[model samples]
Target: MISKWNYLPLSPEQDAIKKKLVRELSLSPVLCELLVQRGVTSITEAKKFFHPQLSDLHDPFIMNDMDKAVERLDRAMGGKEKILIYGDYDVDGTTAVALVYKFLRNFYSNIDYYIPDRYDEGYGISKKSIDFASENDFKLIIALDCGIKAIEKVAYAKSKGIDFIICDHHMPDEDLPDAVAVLDPKRTDSAYPYSHLSGCGVGFKFMQGFAINNDIEIKKYLYPLLDLMAVSIASDIVPITGENRILAYHGLKQLNTCPSLGLQSIIHLCGLKNRELTISDIVFKIGPRINASGRMQSGKEAVDLLISKDMEGAKAKSENINQYNEDRKKLDSQITNQANEIILKNCKDLDKRKSIVIYNADWHKGIIGIVASRLTELYYKPAVVLTYSNGLVTGSARSVQGFDIYKAIEYCRDLLENFGGHTYAAGLSLKEENIPHFINRFESYVSENILPTQMSPQLDIDINIEFNEITPSFFRTLKMFNPFGPGNTNPIFCTKNVYDYGTSRLVGRELEHLKLEMVDSRSENIMNGIAFGMHEYNDHIKSHKPFDICYTLEENTHNGASNMQLMIKEIRPSE
Candidate 1:
């Protein structure tokens, strides 16, 4: 599919800010422009952005109910109460559970962790888990990455003499749970300065507050667990800015230098043990392996691997999780292909449809989110992929850029038994018979709310620059913008008048990728680039034709030699 290129040139005000920043920092105008775009108009702000310090994170107690949460935690440990660490089934949930459990285990002995089975318990705080806690004499439950909306369940736990301390980042409903403490950054009355924390980030803050309250040193106790925080932040797709940046910046350091045994084992299994890691490595490689355990089997297995103490045992567990990842990939591919076929055959006037709601009872429930994502990528529309699970139609929904799938799902809440998620993604369940009504309502809502630009795939080019502008020093500065994700994305540069040198060729197994040695009109330097799935443009590129390309710069290592390589996003023949 051809993509629309969206480039916004700097306005006068932005240009003024960029020039002022350039003057103050003595940096390239382009670099200044990027900084200014990120709302860093001053030199101090730039320094903080590039050099995130752990000390700069907001005071954890500033969040609403944090003091109460910490107090309850202190009381639980003081009384030697059997504390249960509860979390969701995904990467964020598992990581949060692991982080909290690891920290508390250092001081407290009467503690255990629990991860609800995805199929058996569904999402969030499950009644079964509450009952299990009650039966196990778990008097206090510290719920991580979830439980902001467990009103009835928390009440039930309260009746059973179990108190709840919720550390969650998801948007909370108006009526908060009657837990001992509800710690969510998104709480309407929250005083927390930064609100975009991942579920695991909230858990980290809770731990931070707990340590501060009890006079525990943060550097020795808390900093070491940032590896888990980094994985959670990246895998959960949270904005990497403010406190998150500090957490991920240090978390990555912990991950690279001294990862826990389980993470190290998984890193070695991923073949990423020797190299420096990035957010992409976590998102694509480590996170999936961790998530696969939950997707294919039990999430508790993931927490077990995360908190493993033995090296050999962690390796064995990593191997098991890797197999689950492999299984998940196969299932994901099959389901995505099947979903595509269903969409193409049943949906007439596909372009006219504002959203997609496809149902297949035979589809695996665990992999529908991936299928929904695939549908959004292929069709460029909000998509819901549903399957029959225990007499209800349950599934995941993925939205295109700028569209809020969660809101769209919530708009049809009367038809849904339960639903919750962020703007771009969500999960929902309803009566099997409500599928048709859901499709219509979801589509109508999207049609009314979604902008036309959202229905088309667009690549937002950061800036235009010639190949000569990319110097070693420039690339080094760019590398300082590490740990990029939703908020702080890696820059995308567009270079025009690019010609493929004679050495360019098709490199992939099916000859479906362009491995290009490119040079532009302004530069004599030959640039190596890869354009994936763009084989149709290979001949056009190789026939001495000049084309404009937009790409993000990445380092490619081949046989122990590293060089700058452009991961090209789009290629358009010069008009």
Candidate 2:
């Protein structure tokens, strides 16, 4: 993909963070500057980031419908009612199902899990699920990572005497679902301070409230559930700030040592044990396999594996998920290549439009969002990639940092049949014929609202530290900002004129990474480095000279050895 090279600098705002850090933390200029650059100007903020805990979490009832949801959950556990945990088919939904199924199963054996099929039932709560629950005498249904827009399904469940509770984070419409308790932070009436909880986070919170109310030792129950929340948080691309930071923070901590059966199967397959896993691991490695089970086959498979009890069962489930991921990878690559070709041939008039919307009768709906991501990478604009068959159109939209895709789609209300997503990601459906008008209208809407400055990718560097100032001790203090993601990101700094000592070929399929050695700019000490997706730039980078680049400090481990290394983000070849 041809990504946009435009970037937002980190100098001006960073200077202010430094000043604030000096006054607030009462520290030396260098340390204070680092804190400020990381959006931690106050001493309190720094303390919290370093030591995130359960106390930093928001009150679960603050989310709209928490009380009602809790009431229904209490009733289910109280009466030993047969409960079905319903969820979507992706990583977020699968993790949610696992989190709820395991938590609830501890108190009630009548608990079972269900994930709707992507092709069969589409997204969210379904009539088929309600019918299944009814047939099995399941009285309580808790919908996770989905059900925010399931008004008809919720009503149908209620009529059948099946009380419903929703633990979701998707944006909701004007009319809320009539479920007995609808827990969603994105609801307009929601007073939850942070609205970016992933589906599992809401599910976790619902369980958290129940655990606290019952005096079940929230940490004992909740801590074990962090790995699930971490997977969802990373997979869904939510901001890792406030409550989310704490969730990802502790989730990652336990993720290293205490993966659940399903997660352990997946982690063992990835050869990760007693290792510090980052958000990128789940994003690129683990999340894909879990999501693949839903996209390529049945979402329920991933859920089954997640809630699997024994190693044998978990391994069997993981093999299925692995197979699906392998199939998905082939399909995704083929479609992405074709979509890129489609854009190159047909999107000549793209620069004039504010958005990119493409539809191919043959495009696979399973990977349209991946295509949308590819389109955004190539075009630097909000994009919607769709597949049309018969009269129905389903598509995925990926937005730039400045564009709120769901809100932008709201402007084209007349053309869409159904639409829902977060600020930067969304999914929608409409008739094939209405697409052109929706495309044209959505373009106009974006052009009117988005600013030129907002089009550039913002790189928020936490601090500017020379290579000499970096020491082994700083890594420990830096990890105080543990569990980095959207809000609490691993620090990136600018280093100028680092010495280059060539590189060794990092052998991997498709040349996924590169390894090199360089001399520290300030100390004249040698340092090891690795850069991802940099093989194509190898010639430009290693063209017989030293280079200045932007990178981040990272810990690299291999063969029972640990060492700090620099992960280069970008490089400028000498002119």
Candidate 3:
């Protein structure tokens, strides 16, 4: 899986701006270049980027129909109407449901929550769940993370005398659902400044709006909910640029200092307690466990773990959820291996194919999405993992950096019974017979539209710098750019004319990692670097010749001492 390295070029004007920022902030030129590349040219922008504040969050009322949504909720609370917090079965949905349910419970007690079973009800506002709400005498249903596309289901609930207030962030269809209020910033008419909020972030905004309308301090209700928002933002893979950044910034603070009992139990269970957890910690460690509940079993258990107030109850639920996560890992690994084998054996000319579409009727639907993502990492192309269930071919799709997978799937809509997703990921179902045609059409669509560059992975190098710049002060300033994600990513710096000082070794249980004592050719500055899964480069580095490397700086603590280490991204022989 070789990738093209794209060394970003800086214009003279941009260089001049970086120089000015360097002079104004009294920072290193390399740090200034990194900031300039991220669109932080001015000191004001740098201040906001480096020091994100909760006060910087936008007003929740800026979202369209926020007032209506809040008013409907207030009415429901005043009338003691049975309000149900409805959400999807994933982490974003479960966390959103938990956040809203717990917050509303603080003020009103006539509230319960519902998470549709992934295997039974599928995704989003289902007809069966609506019928349950109708039969249970529930009058108000606040759908979180979903319902933006549930026009028919919302209408059905409406006919049953149930009103809906939807809080979703997905791209909505033109014909909006006839709910009492739609609280999606992605709504074409929405005025909210930040539109890339996670589902839980949108739900938190509703709570913010409710607090404002009630003349109560918003922080009293909002601060406690930041942990949930952080988990959703990280897990949902939303852009962490605007409000999402603020929420994640503060939410991580809450998670480290005083997490909820459920979160605390999960942290303890994962052995991540007494440490500052990062977005990656939540995304890889915490988020997966939370999502595993929904994927392997009932998502209600996840919501239960999230909203539980007692330590004992949360611990009990955490143990169960942890086991589910363990089970999910086993299945995920087994399915990924099976999918890889299928691709290797079936696809003769893997390079000629623009997309990957593999189907196994016996494949578990719960792990298809994970397997699709895994396949993309190895194949470096759009992948669709399908399984036959209930006489239909159902599956998940994952795309590369610049590809629009949902649009590609939409091109084959005639063959697909239903499909929905954004640019990089989607889900679809079709008849068994249409599987071959859908695969051909989808492959043809991708081959015709996708660019040559889009077919292969590309690493975007932020800047080229010398090892002299890797100082304690420089690393400290870089640490200000915390909570990195899709929109704002960690800076990848390329250092030219670098070589291992006769101390490079392959380290790791499988001897698959390259540990190097890298030295700068110009400054003779030394830095320890580790390239995980790059043992193939051991001979290249041990040659003692100058080479170029791209990497990110990370603080590695060992034996009670902390020092900066380069986490190598790519290595190349110097030209």
Candidate 4:
């Protein structure tokens, strides 16, 4: 599919800032302009952006109910009452549970953790889990990644003499839960500086508040769990800026050097041992394996693997999780194909539709979210993929770049049994009979709100440069923009009027990829690049014609030699 290239040149004000930054930082003008685009105007902000410190993290107690959360947890631990750490069944939730459970288990006994069964119990603060907690004589339930909107479930737990302290980051409703403390940065009344923390991040802040309240040393107990924090932030697709950046930066350092036994085992399984890990590594390789456990089996298995102390046990569990990931991939591919066939055959007016709402009663409930995301990417529309489960139709929603899928889901709340999520993604359940009404309402909401340009893919090019501008030193300086994600993305550079260097060829299986060696008029450098699924352009690329290409620089190693390669995004033949 072709994509529009959207390049926004620096404004005059930004040009002045870029010039100043280039002079002060002694960096290239293009690099300075990129920093200016990221709102780094001065030396101090640039320093902080490049070198994040743990001390730069916000005060945990600044959150509204953080004091109550810490005090309640302290009282629970002080009295030796049974404490249950409960969380949702995803990467963010499981990591939050593992981080909290691992931290508290060091000083407190009579503590346990619970993960809601994705099939049997469904998502978030299930009464079944509450009953399990009560049956085991638990007194306090610290809910992570969920329970901010569990008004009735918290009331039910309260009736069972179980107090709840919710640590969540999803957007909240007008009425808060009756829990002892609600720690969510998205809360309207929240004063916390950063609102984009992952669910595990909120749990980390709760632990931070607890440590500060009790005067426990942070270096030994708290900082060690940053590996889990990094996983959650990267996997959950949270904005990697401010406090999240600081945590992800250090968390990646920990992962590369001395990760937990569980992560280390999985890293070995991924064949990534002895290599530096980045946010992309977590998103593409590590996070999926962790999520596969929750998607295929119980999420408690993921937490077990994450907090495992024994290397052998963790290695075995990592193998199990890897199998689950393999199974998940098969299911995801099959279901996505089926969904595509359904849309093509049934929905004849596809172009007129602004959103996608597809249902397959036989679809696996755990794999629908991935399918929804795939549908959004394939059709460039907000999508909802639903499957039959426990006599109800449960579904996952994924949105386009600028659309808010959760609000669209909430607009159909009266028809839904339950729904909660963030701007770009969400989940919901409804009676099977209400499926038609829900689809119509959801489509109507999306059609009314989605912008015209949002329905198409656009590649935001950071700057246009010549091949001569890409030096070894320049690439080394670019490496400092580590741990890239939603807010701070890897820069995409475009170069025009470039022709293949006569060594380009098709390489991948079935010859569906382009392995290119190219040069431009400005330089004799024959840069190497690989463009996947662009075999259609192979002849044109070799026709001695120039084309404009936008790509991100990546380090490729072969036979112990490392050099820069362009991970090409889009190619436009010169007109």
What is the model-wide C-alpha lDDT for candidate 1?
0.91
Q: Put down candidate 3 lDDT per residue, 442-481, tens digits, no spaces.
A: 9999999888887677999888888887888889989898
Name the better of 1 and 3 by TM-score.
1
Model 4, residue 424: C-alpha shift (Å): 0.9
For candidate 1, the C-alpha RMSD (Å) to the true structure equals: 1.2
Candidate 2 segments whose C-alpha is farther than 4 A from its true place:
1-31, 389-391, 453-460, 501-516, 519-523, 531-546, 573-575
lDDT of 1 at 190: 84
Candidate 1 lDDT over 458-567, as tens digits, reads: 99989999988898888888888888998889999999999987899998899999999989999798999999999999888879999999999998888899888999
The residue pairs that clash in candidate 2, if any, are 17-36, 37-462, 50-480
Q: Could you tell me which residue pairs clash in candidate 4?
A: none
Candidate lDDT (C-alpha), each: 0.91, 0.80, 0.89, 0.93
In Å, residue 510's CA in model 3 sits off its true spot by: 3.5
What's the CA error at residue 384 for candidate 3, in Å? 1.3
Query: If both were scored by lDDT, which would come out higher, candidate 3 or candidate 4?
Result: 4
**Candidates sorted on lDDT, descending:** 4, 1, 3, 2
